[model samples]
Target: MPRFGGPEVLELDRHHPDPVPGPDQVVVRVHAASLNHLDLAVREGIPTLKLTLPHILGCDAAGDIAEVGSDVTDVEVGDRVVVNPGVSCGRCEYCLRGEDSECVEYKILGEHLPGTYAEKVAVPARNVLKIPTDMDFPQAAAVPLAFMTAWRMLITRAKVRPGEDVLILGAGSGVSTAAIQVAKLAGCTVFTTSSSDAKLEKAKALGADVLVNYKAMPWSKAIWELTGKRGVDVVVDHVGEATFKDSVRSLRKGGRVVVPGATTGALLELDARYLFWRQLSVLGSTMANQREFEEVMKLVFMGRLKPVVDRVFPLEQARQAHEYLGRGEQFGKVVLAIDTPD
Candidate 1:
């Protein structure tokens, strides 16, 4: 976007020059780019994210390798791949410890650097993973950010176990779409809330055992009653101030609430008594570490997990795509097609 404000600020620069790879980087001929709530946040100029004006906005991408750096050897040109958007200095202690998200200089694709909203983008060679020929570019693009973040939140931070009661808030989001499936595959009885009944129904097909329309009724109370007043074991909430307190309230004693992003304002107040008396764990998470990314993408490649893409738009219509997402009408992800195959 030219300047942070709204979707109107986004400009389609079709004449923008393609990127050149560094010695450790590779140039990708981008086919598809997926939108995240993060894209909207960065566009609006979050105070903490300090992005340069006229930022390119897209965190998840998939395409073919167009050029390889001299030092790159693992993959060659013409390889179909998905890019891992998280970037960290490989020399950092956190990266060495497999906690790349905590690196002193952690950067995400599009957020901290030039992003995937172009015909081509340059990313570190290690960031691209080859995808099976059967997976199309738009589908591959939908996998990176949402799946990686959800994997870390559920498996790494929440440590969700089999037969647990897990609640996923905002079933319409990309992360929640991935979270519901991940929880189900882990054998959890999932509960999810959405304002739209159609979205909730889709969540059911994704293995959500309880679907609550938060618009029609208070979701926490409904979940509490559904679980026989015992509450659930884990609550996945990224909605922030709008649902943070209710998310905490829906958890059972010693239960945890995991968050990847806060789409709503972040300054939500929490009562210390709720934390102390209930022994609840509220964990904050961002994009995944490399280890988590690889592990999760393996499942995505194996077709054991799937990405839900709500709509597709051509690159020139990126501003309209962002506005569509901002309206919260999409049931899952909104992807932009850059170099779609003939």
Candidate 2:
């Protein structure tokens, strides 16, 4: 898949085996891989990413260690683990200061480098998180990217407080599903928007306190009424240009809007007066730090946060998986299951 444009670009080709891991790397026998909106962006091609042709396109996975390089320590062959895609040079000043996501050379696994959509992938030992013995590969595969992005945006950047109200835009998105659960865990009331009734039902099952059908109601106005005209304490918005202004209007004075992506088009129009007068904060967050990843995964393992998987497709059906996700009807993560058993 060197080419770009649509899911058709994801062509399957058998090439030479992936090289053996270097000193600090390990090879994983991939079991399950999950999708994200970022996958769509990469498939369509982004301005910042300049990659070699025929790149892989998955960001989240859970697998067993097949081979370990000589210098690898703390992990061994047959160990079960999940891949954490956010990679940063440990020597960078930001990483040194414990802000790894802000590293000058931060890169993600599937986008910038070869990814785990294949049957096997090699990753730095530092980028792998050990999974609990009792968990399944598909469940573990759901944790890394979506949950981490949600955790960083809601907990770290937004500082979502207990008992507050939070609104998550686009209930069909993976991050939105994660946000609903995370917000509920924080003791917050969650409101979510969906274009479909079926998706709204699924969102409610995940602990959403209020559901707004964007087709039936003006979401911002509905949120205002749902909160008794006070609006919510925070809004988790990744819907971009289509919903950004509505997201802003749906917040209370001094409330914050945390954005981790722009799915619905990027260029947004805003009123300067609303931003200044309302004392609003628009926080931008990407992926999570190592500590955050560790913290959130612990919860996932403990069943405190469950990754909602919408569907799983075979690895060869990558194009179909992308098409399903691109349709925006999925209520949770769309995963690609590697048929090979580990």
Candidate 3:
């Protein structure tokens, strides 16, 4: 986007510079890239995140390796791969400990750096993971940020286990869709809320054990009654201020609430009494580290978990795609298909 504003700000830049890889990076000829709420936030401008104008906005992508730097040995040209969006200073203590998301200089693709909206993007060698030949570009593109963030939030931060009940607020989002599958795969009974019944049905197909139409009734009350008044063990809440208090209300004593992103608004209101009396744990997570990224991708490759792509738009139609995503109607990930050279 030339300047942060609305979907109208997104313009096709035919003359945008092609990326060149650093000594330890690789240039990927992007075939597909997925949209996230982060894209919308960055496009509209986040007060704290100052960007160099004319920034590219896309986080998750999959493509063929167009060029490899001298120091890149594992991946070769023409390899099918997915890019891990999280970039960290490898020298940081958090990075050394495999907690790259906690690194002091942690940055995300399209957020702190140039992103994959273009035909070519340069990413760190360590951030490139080869995808199975069976996985198509758009499917691979939809996996990274959403699945990685969900994996870290549920598996790493929340430590959700079998038989535990998980309440994932907002069933239509990319991360929430992935979280439903992850929770199911972990043997948890999943409860999800959506305003649309059609979306609730789709969430059920993804292994959601209980579905609540938040539009029909109060979701927290529904969850309370559904769980027989015991409440859920974990609440995965990304819709922040709009539902954060209700998310807290939906949790049982000592239950955990994991937040990966706040799509609605950040400043939340919650009853401090519930936190102190119930001894609830609130955990904040971002994109996964290298190991966590690979772990979740392996599941994706194995078909144990799958990405839900709601719609696909050609690269030139990014403004339309952004507008569609902004309407908040997509049931899953919205993707942009990039036309690569022959």
Candidate 4:
């Protein structure tokens, strides 16, 4: 964006210089890129994040390798691949332990670096993974950030298991859409909340065992009553101040609340008694590590898990896509299809 503000600040720059690959990076000709709430936050200006002018905004991308760094040999030009948005210094202690998200220099595509909204983007060589032959660019692009975040949150941080109840707040968001599937794949009975009954029905179709329209009644009370007053075993709550307290109330004793990102508002308030007395756990998770990424992508490739693409827009209509996403109307990922460069 030229300057951070509303979606109108987004402009199409066809003549922008193509990116050059670093020694350990590869330049990808992005075929498809997907939107995330992070993009909107970055465009509007995050209080803690500083960005250079005219920064691109997209985290997940699927494309072909246009060029590889001199030292790279595992992949070649024209290879179809998906980009892992998380970038970290390999030498860090966290990276050595395979926790790249906790690396000292960890950064995400479209956040701390140039992103994949254009025809070409440069990413680390190790960050590119081959996609299944059957998967389209838009489907592949929708997988990385959303699936990985949900995977790490449920499988790694929360450690959810079979026969448990997982309450995922917000049925229509990209992460929530992915979380419902992930929680189901883990054999958990999923409960999700949305203001719209239509979205609740869609969430139900995604393996949600119980759907509550928050507009119809209080969600926490609904969940509490639905689970026979015992509460859920895990709560996936990224809706910060708006729902955190209720999420706490909806969890069972010794339950876990896994948070990936907060979309509503950050500052949260809750009763401490519920936390300590119930031995509740609130875990924060970011994008997955390489191992977790591969694991979840394997499920995606195997057809056990699927990426939901709500709509497709041409690259030039990014402003419209942003507006659509900002309105919270999409049931899944909104993708931007990039035109092939001549």
lDDT of each: 0.90, 0.89, 0.94, 0.93
lDDT of 3 at 219: 94
Q: Model 4: which residue pairs collide?
A: none
Candidate 1 C-alpha lDDT tens digits along 1-342: 778888888898756777889998999999999999988888888788887666788899999999999999998999999999988998878889989998999998888899989888899999999999899999999999999889999999999999999999999999999999999999999999998999999999888999999888899989989988889999998999888998899899999999787888787668899899999998988889888999999999898899999999998889899999999988888999995443
Q: Give the lDDT of residue 160 in candidate 1.
A: 96
Better of 2 and 3 by TM-score: 3
Give the per-residue Cα lDDT of candidate 4 at 229. 94
Better of 1 and 3 by TM-score: 3
Q: By lDDT, who's the top model here?
A: 3
Name the better of 1 and 3 by lDDT. Answer: 3
Question: For model 4, how does the per-residue alpha-carbon lDDT over 1-342 read when each residue is reduced to its tens digit?
Answer: 899999999999878899999888899999999999999999999989988888999999999999999999998999999999999898989999999999999999999999989999999999999997889999999989999999999999999899999999999999999999999999999999999998989998899998898788899999989989999999998889888888988889999988788889998777788889999998999999999999999899999998999999999999999999999999999999998865
Worst 10 residues of 2 by lDDT: 11-20
Cα shift from native, residue 12, model 3 (Å): 0.7
Let me know the TM-score candidate 4 reaches against the reference structure. 0.99
Q: What is the overall TM-score of model 2 with all chains considered together? A: 0.97
Candidate 2 lDDT tens digits, 252-312: 9999998899998988778889999999999999999999999998889889999888898
Model 1, position 73, has a per-residue lDDT of 98
TM-score: model 3 vs. ground truth: 0.99
**Colliding residue pairs in candidate 3:** none
lDDT of 1 at 126: 95
